[model samples]
Structures are given as structure tokens and as C-alpha cells.
Target: MKILLIGEYSRLHNSLKEGLMALGHEVTIVGCGDKFKQFPVDFSIYARICNDNKIANFLFKSIRKVIGFNLEKIEKAIRFYLLLSKLNHYQHVQLINSDALETYPILSRFLYKKLFQNIQSRSLLVCGDETPIIDYLFKKEFKYSVLTPYFEDNSIEKEFQFPLKYRNKNYRKTFNWLVKNCQNLITSDLDYEIPMQKMGFQTTFIPNPINTDKITFQNIGITDKIVIFLGINRLSYSKKGIIYFEKALEIIREKYADKIEIIVSENLPYSEYISTYNRAHILLDQVFAYDQGYNALEAMAKGKVVFTGAETEFLNQYQLQADDVCINAKPNENEIAKKLSFLIEDPEKINKISKNARKFIEKEHAYKIIAEKYFTSWN
Candidate 1:
């Protein structure tokens, strides 16, 4: 099958391309490398003209903020229009999300509708970010969500510019059109699955593909200090529950400063990030997800005991017990600190969980296995 994946998020589509190629299918990925993270793709359409020229970028942003027009959007619209011919004529085309093309909402909707007409089968991946899901999440009162901080402190509105756009009628209509036209919806995690199902769309949950072969698993031995690593992205700090993790880490640090070492990597590219904390024993990932995101899953593939979403829903789906595979971080700082403290005090249990974490990735999220699922779903 000739498949075209139309976006890159945390290397999800890149890894999926590898898996599909291993299965002897022709796959081409087109994306912008997801901004600074710099994930690879066959066709790089990240709007380099606007991004490379800092002066122009700043000018355009300033104009957008002052007035209502976005010069960068106009530039992207022209670029996307020129690339439309190259983007067509595929057996299957899957968008990482509704907003795959780097254009304004109206333009993105038009391009998606055009692409849908050109492709034989069109699918949408309900990735971590989508307007419908975000809108739905805001409607309900989640114990903790990406919008928790924003709701608690309205001052953070400046930081969360996307959600404001997401709440707009234009954005909602664009996503709704894509959802209605797509042949099928694919969800990579439970966070997306729950909202998508609630919105009355039948979805196929395919675990995010992790290239396990690239990661080496190491058995953690008893050491003087337990190294806990936290990689922070300011853009998603509130959503990922970094504040809770930080508070928990503060307590743990004060209590066991001599026994544990906390290492933090902030805003590093994907390649540098994995290598930077390769030797760390534990990785503190997000706290508000029902299932692990790509970062957590990749750390698990590396045999790191990741503190992430391993809620009852995730456990029940995988038929495993919590704390056996991954540490389930709660919204409360005390609970998070307690869970971290438990692992810090026990070396043998960490080693056991570390092995289980890798095994879980191999059994469930291996690229080939997940790619086959994609193939079947597209068929």
C-alpha cells in the first residue's frame, strides 16, 4: 500500500513509517518536525521561511497580536497550495491530527477537504491535541487535565493561546468537518480514545509505536544514589502536571538529598533528550494521563521505570497491576512523592519494574506490531 502520513508528533509518524516499510509497504511522511523537537520526515513542510527569519517571524507575530491578521498564515497558505499536488494520489492518507497542514483554520479545512477527495482512504489520528477533544475536556470537570492550570488561574491565558482558538466556532467546525468525512478515527492513547468515543465516533485504539530495537535496556543495580530524571517543556508544564511533580520532588529532595539525585533536562531536542538522561534510573513523565504518552513510552522502552499514567483503565486494558509495570502518578503531590519514595528505597523492585517496562513495550507497542494494526485498520 502507498501510504502518506501527514504530520509528525513526537516521532510517532516517523516510527510508524519505519514499521510500515519493514512490512514492505510504501510510506511517505510529510511534517514540520514538530517545531523544535525536530522529528524526521520525508517531506519537510515546517514553513522554514517564517521560522528561519527571526526578524520576519517576530514582525509577523507582533502584527498578529496587535491587529487580527497573521502574515505567517498567509505565507503558509501559499506554501501549502504549492505542495498540494505532491500531497495527493495516495492509496491511504492519515493526518496526525485535523490541523496537520501548517495553514489557517479555514485554509487547513479546505486543504483537508481537498486531500480527502484525492485519497482513496482517509483517516485521522486523534493525537494528544485536537479541538473536539479539548473542547470536550473543558466541558467536563476532570480531576486534572491540560486545562486545569488555566481554569485555576486565568492569568495563564497568555500561555495557553491555542485553547482560545480551539474554543472558537471556526476551529470546531473545521475539526467537525474532518471527523465527519474521515473513513476511520485512530487513537494512540486512552486520553484521546475516551473523548472520541464520547463524541460518538467509532475509534480504533492502536498503541503508539516505539522503536524498541533502538533502545537498550539496562538492569539497574544497587547504587548509592537513585538518579531521578525530569524533562520539562515549558509549553506543556501545566498540562503534564509538572508542578505536582516538582512539589513532590522538593519534598523527596529535602528528605533524601543524600540518597537520591534529581536531574532535569529542559526544552532539549528529541535526540539530545534521550541521550542526556540515558543513565538515569527513573524518568518522571506526565501526571494527568490515563495512559503513557510518547515520552513515557519511549522511556519505558529504555528500561527506565517511568512515573506516568497507569490508571485503572490502562491497567485493566493491559491486564496488569499498577506499580508492576509503571508508577501511576496521581494529581496530589504527596501521593506522587510517596510513590517516588517507595521506588527510591527499593532497588530490587526497581530492577523488576524496569524489566517489566521494557517487556510491556515489546509486547504491546513494538513498531511492527503497531504497524500491522495500522495496516489492518486502513484496509
Candidate 2:
């Protein structure tokens, strides 16, 4: 099948495209922003669909101004998207991105009525984390699918995490449409299926895709007197939880002092961080959640003992446990310090977990398995 995958979500398109290729499907990707530099796929043929220009800023501001279905901005954005869509109509496209478009409120009626009147085998695929635009297009019969990032199954914690202020009538209407038109909604954990069903969205179980082959776990061999703790983010203190890591390091430095070193890796000069990871025994990925981002995955691939609360599926596939992967602490410095002490004092346990980390990812999160998952989803 000839497929057009739209939007780039944490290198998801690159991985999925590779999988699709292996399955003998023709795949092209249209990334929204910067393409993942490390992706191993060749998408030059279909890369033109990406709207990487300065217009994104204008669209964002205009959409923000449309608090309650502001029709003027909606028409403007629709004209923009439609022009892009018309330009790329040769390919069967599937738009996968955030669904807060002004087009849904004012322009979707037009999209369903006339814009796509000539187009077939093209539709939008919405991720179910935020407000979906399905509600407005339901009666219009737009081909669509919904995928949810179920953080947990039992708690329904994700919903509560967002406050009521973020809610808008437009958003609610779109979400209601998603619950009705979504071909399927996927959760990483099987436990989430029930909650999704309760919410009136069809649910399926699918783990997060990991490109294990590219992240090959190698033994960096850090057997020395100085223990290292790593924090990986783009040097920014706010988004990557750098402040929390710094506070925790301060507490540990007061006690351990010169015994341990804390190194932070951000989007800095490559020369600066290359050695930092090499010297460290443990890399701290993120404090926002138990799951590891690309940074954590890269650290684990290097065979370093990663202290994180990253989800279990990816780690468990390698026979690694939560205790082994991360310290599983909130952004509390004291809590992080306590976990650090345990790892420093007990080298044997650390070594065991580090060993498990490499093996688990290789066996389970490899590209071969990930590619298959993508194929299953499309089929």
C-alpha cells in the first residue's frame, strides 16, 4: 500500500516508516518540524508535504486567538491547510498530529463538503491526548482514527492532570466526536482498555515503539572509584527537570561530596557531553514521569545504569525492572539522593541492573518488533 504518514512525534514517523518499508509497503512521511537527525529512513520523495516554514507561528497565534470557534481564523487556517493538501494530493495522506485546528469548528464543514470532494483514500488520524476535531466532522463522514496515550489504566490520572481551564466548548465537542468516530483507540497497557471503553472509545493494547537497533546497548566500561550520575536534557532547566536534578545533586554532594559526580547532558556542543556520558555510571533521563525519553533510551543502550521511573514494558522486555532502571522518585531531591546512595553503596546490584538493561532492550524494543507493531496497526 502507498501510505502518507503525517507529523513527527518523537521520531515515531521514522520508526514507523522503516517498519512499513520492511513489510513491503510504500511509505512517505511529512514531518511538521525538524526531522529527527538520527533517523535511518530515506523520505526525500514525500518530504515536501511538511510545512516547516514560518507560517506555523502565524497559524499558532491565530488559532490561539480563536478561543471559541472563531470563524475568521478557522477559514484562514483551512485555506492554508487545503492549499497544502491540494498541492500534495497525488499521495494518500493520513494526518497524525494535535487536533486543535480552527478548521474543525468553521472550516471542516467546507472540507467535507467541497475541499476533499475530489480526494479519496485520504483522512486524518488523531492522537487522543488532547481535544480531537472529530465532533465537527462526524456527520460529514471524514475517514479518521484515534490513538490514545494511556498513562495508566485504573487511575484515569491523565484526565485529572489537566485543569478545567484548558477545557473549551470547541475542545469538548471535538473530543465527543473522537469517542464516536475513532476506528480504534490504543493504550500501551492492557489495563487501560477498560477505562477507554467506559469513556466510549474503542480501545486496543499496544506498547510504545522503541528503535532498539539504532540504540544498540554497548558496554562503556565505567568501573572506577568515582561514581557518576547523569541528567540528560537540552541544557534547559525547566522542561527537562534540570532544576530538580541540580537540587538533588546538591544534597548528595553535601554528603558524598567528592565521592560522586553529577553530569548533565543537554543540546550542547557534542564535544561537551560525549565524555560526560563516558565517565558516568548512571544517567538520569527525566523526572516528569516514570518513562524514559530518547535520552534515557540512548543511556541504557550505552549499558549505563539509568536511574528512572520509565514504564515497564520496554524495560521488562530486556529483563530489567523499575528498581533497576530508575530510582522512581518524584522531583524531590531528598528522594533522589536516597536512591543514589543505595546504588553507590551497592555496586553488585547496580551492575546486575545495568547488565539487565542492555539485554532487555536488545531482545524486546528492537526495530524488528517495533516495525511489526506499526504494520499491525495499519492493517
Candidate 3:
């Protein structure tokens, strides 16, 4: 099969490509390296002209803010339009999210319609930051969702922009066009699967693919000074409940300054970010997800106990116990601190969870296994 993956989020498509290739399929990935995180891709649409010229970038941004129209978006739309001829006629094309083209509504609609007509088979990957899923999440009013912080305090303008844009007439129309036109909708985790199903879209839920060969498991030994790593992206701080994690980290540091070591990397490139936390005993990932994202899954594959959203739904889906495989983090500061404290005090428990974490990834999210699933689904 000749497959074309249209976008990327935290190297999800790259991993999937590796899996597909290993299964003897030709796969090509085109993306913008997901902005500064810089995940690799076969074809890159990442534009540096405006961004490299600080003056032009500033002017473009200021103009957008003052006039409610982004010139940069228009430029991206033109670029994508020119790339359309190159993107057509694949056996399969999977958009990473609804906003895969990264353009304004008019251009997005045009590009999506063209791509849908050109491709042999079209599919949608319900990964993070998708407009439809986010809109649905806001509508359902989940008790603790990515939009909770924005709802709790409307002052979060940046975080609130997603819901605002998704609710707009133009964005909604474009989203509906793609949703109706796509042949199959797939979700890598329960976070998206549940909401998509609620919205009356039949979605296939597949566990995220982790390149197990690349992430070799290391047997974590019990050590007196336990290191905990927390990587933060300022843009997603509120949505991922990082404020709560920060509060908990402060408490943990104050209480066990001598026994615990906290390592924090802020917005590092993907390659550097992953390597930065390799020595840590635990990884603090997102708090609002029902299942782990790529980073958490990658960390878990490396035999590190990751504190993420392994809720009851995720546990039952995998038929595994929560505390044993991964730590289910809540939005509450006290509960997060308590969970961190428990692991800090017990080295044996960390080792046990680390082993279970690696095993879980091998069984459920290994790249080959996940790629096979995709092959079957696409066929």
C-alpha cells in the first residue's frame, strides 16, 4: 500500500510510518515538524521565511491582532495550495487532525475537498488539538477536560481561542465538510474515541504506536535519590493541568528536598526533550487525558513510571490495573502531590511500575503490532 500521512503530532505519524514500512508498505509523511518540537518527516511544509524575518513576523502578527485577519495564515494557504498537486493520488491519506492544512477556513475547505476527491481512501486521525473533538469536548462539558481551565477562568484567551474558532461558522462548516467526506475516522486513544462516538461518528480506536525497538527498556533500580522529570509547553499548560502539577511539585520539593530530584525541560525540541528525561525515574505527563499521549507512551516504553491519565476507561480497555501499570493523575493538587509522594517514598514500587509500564507498551503499543492493526483497518 502507498500511504500518505498528512500531519504529525508528537511524532505519531512518524512512528506509524516506521510501522507501515516495516510491514512492507510504502509510507510518506508530510508535515511541519509540529512547529518547534521538530519531529522528522519525509516532506516538510514548515515555512521559515516570515518566522526567520523577525520584523515581518512581528508586523504580520500585529496586523492579525488589530484587524482580525492573519496574513501568515493566508501565506500558509497559498503554500499549501501550491503543494496540492504533489499531495494527490495516494492509496491512503490520513489527516492528523481537522486542521492539518493549517490555513484559514476558505482555503482549508478548498484543500480538504480537493484532497478528498484526489485520494483513493481518506481517513481522519483524532489526535490532540483537533477542532471537532475540542468543540465536542466543550459541548459535552466533561467534568475535567482540556477546556476546564478556560471555563473556570475566561481570562485564558490563548487557551480559549480553540473553542472560539471551532464554534465559528466558517470553521464549523469546514470541519463538517471533512467529517462527512472522510472514508474512515480513527482515534489513537479513548480521549478522542469517546467524544467522536458521542458525535455519531463511528471511529476505530487504536492504541498509539510506540517504536519499541527504538525505545529499549532499561531495568530501573531502586535508588535513594529518585529523579522526577516534568516537561512543559507553555501553550498547553492550562489544558494539560500543569499548574496543578507545578503546585504539587513545589510541595514535593519542600517536603522531600533531600530525597527527591525534579528535572524540568521547557519546550525543548523533540529529540532533546526525550533524551533530557532518560535518566529520570518518573515522568509527569498530562493530567486531563483518559489515556497516555505519545510522550507518556514513549516514556512508559522506556521503563519509566509515567504519571498520566490511565483512568478506569483506559484500564478496562487494556485489562490492566491502574496503580500497577501507570499512575492515574487527577486535576487536584493535593491528590497529585500525594501520588508523587507515594512513589518518592517507595523505590521498590517505582521499579515494579517501571517494569509493568514497559511490558504494557510492548503488548499494546508496539509499532509493528499497531501498524498491522492499521493495515487491517485500511484494507
Candidate 4:
């Protein structure tokens, strides 16, 4: 079958493309390299003039003020329009998310409608905090989610524009468009799956595909000091519960300053981000997720002990205990600090989880195996 995978996030679709190709299926991907992370794609419409050209930025702002639309997005929609013919006539077409093309709602509906006209099968992947997922998160269904900060204190409205914008009526119409047109809605993680289930959608749950062949496991060797790494994206600090990690790191620094080395980097490009954490024995990942995000999963694949969302829902799904494969970092700063101290005091635990982490990825998320699952589901 010829498959057209739309959009890229943390190289999820890229890895899926590789797996499908290996399984003797032709696959093509069209996306912007997911901004700074710069994941590769076949057709690249992700370039922008507004960022580099003052005139373009001025026009975009002027247009947005008058017409309630970004001029840059209009240009992107045109660029995507030119590629629709090439993207058509596929046996299967899957969007990485609802906003795969990254255009405004109305523009996206026009483009997506054209692309889907000749496609045999249409599907949507719920991989991030988009309209449907945010609708679920808004109800305070989970104990704590990425929106916990806003739920507790609504002062930080500026940081939440991306997720909050999906609540607009126009965005809701586009999402409903996809829901009505697509044959199936698929989830790539437990975070998405649980909420999707609660929303009463019979969506298929497929674990995010990780290319184990490319990511070789590195055994943790704690010689003198345990290196702990924390990466931050300034835009998502509160949403990802990264602020909690920052607070926890302070406690760990104050107490176990002699036994460990802490490295913190912010807003790194994809390649740089991965390299920055390579030397670490422990990685502090997101706090508000029931399952690991792409960065945490990649770290685990490389045999680095990761502190991410491995909640009881995740544990029961995998039949594992707390801190078994990866440490489940809650919203509490003290809890995170205590976990770090335990790892520093007992370095053997790091190595044990590191090995187990690699095994878990290979067993559950291998790209080829996951690709076959996609193929079977699509059939």
C-alpha cells in the first residue's frame, strides 16, 4: 500500500515512514520539520519569511489586526495547496494531529478537504494537546495534567495560547470536520488514549513508534559522580510541569551537590537537545503525563534513566511497579527531589532501570513492529 503520512512531531511520522518502507510499503511524508527540532520531511513548507523579514512581520500583524488572520499562515496555506496534487491518490493518509498542516482552521479545512478527496483511507493521530484532548483536560478529569497550572491559577494565560486557541469556535468546526470525514482516530500514547476513551470515541490505541535500530542503548556507568540532565523549553515550562523540575533540581543541588553533576540547557534544537543529555545518568523529563513523551522515550531507548510520567495507569498497562522502568515524577517538588536522592545514594538502581528502559522500548515500541500494527489496523 502507498501511505501518505502528514506532519512530523518528535520524528514520530518519520520513524513510521521508515518502518512502513522496510515492510515493503511506499510511504511519503509532508511537513515542516516541527520548528526548531528540524525533523526531516519530503515536502518542506515550514520555512517562514515573517521571522526574517520585518516587512512580512508588519504585514502579518496588520492583516491579523484587521481580518483576524495571520498573513504568514495564508502564505503557508498557499504553499501547501501547491502540493495537494502530489499528496493525493494515496491508499492511506494519516495526519500527525488535527493541525498537521499548521494553518488556521478555515485554511486547514480547505487544504485537508482537497487532499482527502482522492484518498482511500483517512485517519487522524492524537499525539499532543490539541482540541479534543484539551476539551478532556479542561474538565479536571485527571489528578493533574499539563493544564494544572492554569487550573490552579489562571494568571499565566499568555503561555497557553496554542492549546487554548483550539477552543475557539472556528477550530472546533475544523476538528468536527476531521471527525466526520476520517474513518478512524488513532492515539499514539496512553495520555491521549485514556482521555479519548473517556470522550467516548472508539479510537485505536497504538504506542508511539520508536526506531530502536537507530538509537543504540548506552549502559549507565556511574564512576565518581552521577550526571543528571534537565532540558527546558521556555514556552512549555508551566504546561509541561517543567517548573517543578526546576524547583526539584534546586533541592537536589542543595543536598547532594557533592555526589552529582547537574546540567541544564534551555530551548535547544533537536540534535543539540539529544546530545546535551547524552552524558547524564538521570534525565528529568515532564511531570504531567501518564506516559512518556517523545523526548523521554528516546532517552529511555538510549538506556538513560528517565524521570517522566509513569503513573499507575501506565504501570497497570505494562504490569510494572513504580520506578521500575522509569521514575514517575509527580507534581510535587519534594517527591522529585527524593527520587533524585534515592538514585544518587543507590547508583545501582540507575543502571538497573537503564537496562530495563532499553528492553521496554524494544519490546513495546520497535518501529517495525509498530508499523505492522498500523498496517493491520488500517486494513
Put the candidates in TM-score order, highest first.
Answer: 4, 3, 1, 2
Q: Local distance difference test, per candidate?
A: 0.85, 0.50, 0.84, 0.89
Q: Compose the digit string of candidate 3's lDDT tens values, residues 1-379.
A: 8899987768999999999999999999877787779989887777665566898889877887898887766776677777778877688888887778677888888877777677868888888766667768778556678887777888877766755677778877877777788777889998888888877778888889999998899888755689999999977888899888899999999999999889998989999998899889989998988889889999999999998998888888888876878899999989999999998887889999999999899999999999999888877
Return the clash pairs for model 3, or none: none
Task: Give the least accurate 10-residue stretch of model 4, judged by summed lDDT.
Answer: 44-53
RMSD of 1: 1.6
lDDT of 1 by residue, 1-379 (tens): 8999988878899889989999999999887787779988887777676778998888878888899787766776776677779877689999998777756889888777677778868899987778868877887645667777788899988777765676778777877888778888899998888887777778999999998777667777756789999999988888788989899999999999889988998999899998988878999999888889999998998889999988888998899987888899888999999988888787888999999999999999999899999999988
lDDT of 2 by residue, 1-379 (tens): 7666655535556665666677777776644233223333233221222233456545655666775434344444544465555334433444443332323433433333343344344444433334422232222222211112112232443333332212457546544544444344545322233234444555454544556655555654546654565544442233345556678778777787756766655454333454567667777765644345444555676677776544444345435556764455456677777888887777776777677777755655565576676456545
| Candidate 3 wrong stretches, greater than 4 Å | 139-141
Query: Model 4 scores what on Cα lDDT?
Result: 0.89
- Candidate 1's displacement at residue 336, Å, is 1.3
Q: Highest TM-score, which number? A: 4
TM-score of each: 0.95, 0.64, 0.96, 0.96
Clashes of 4: 0
Which has the higher TM-score value, candidate number 3 or candidate number 4?
A: 4
Over all chains combined, what TM-score does candidate 4 have? 0.96
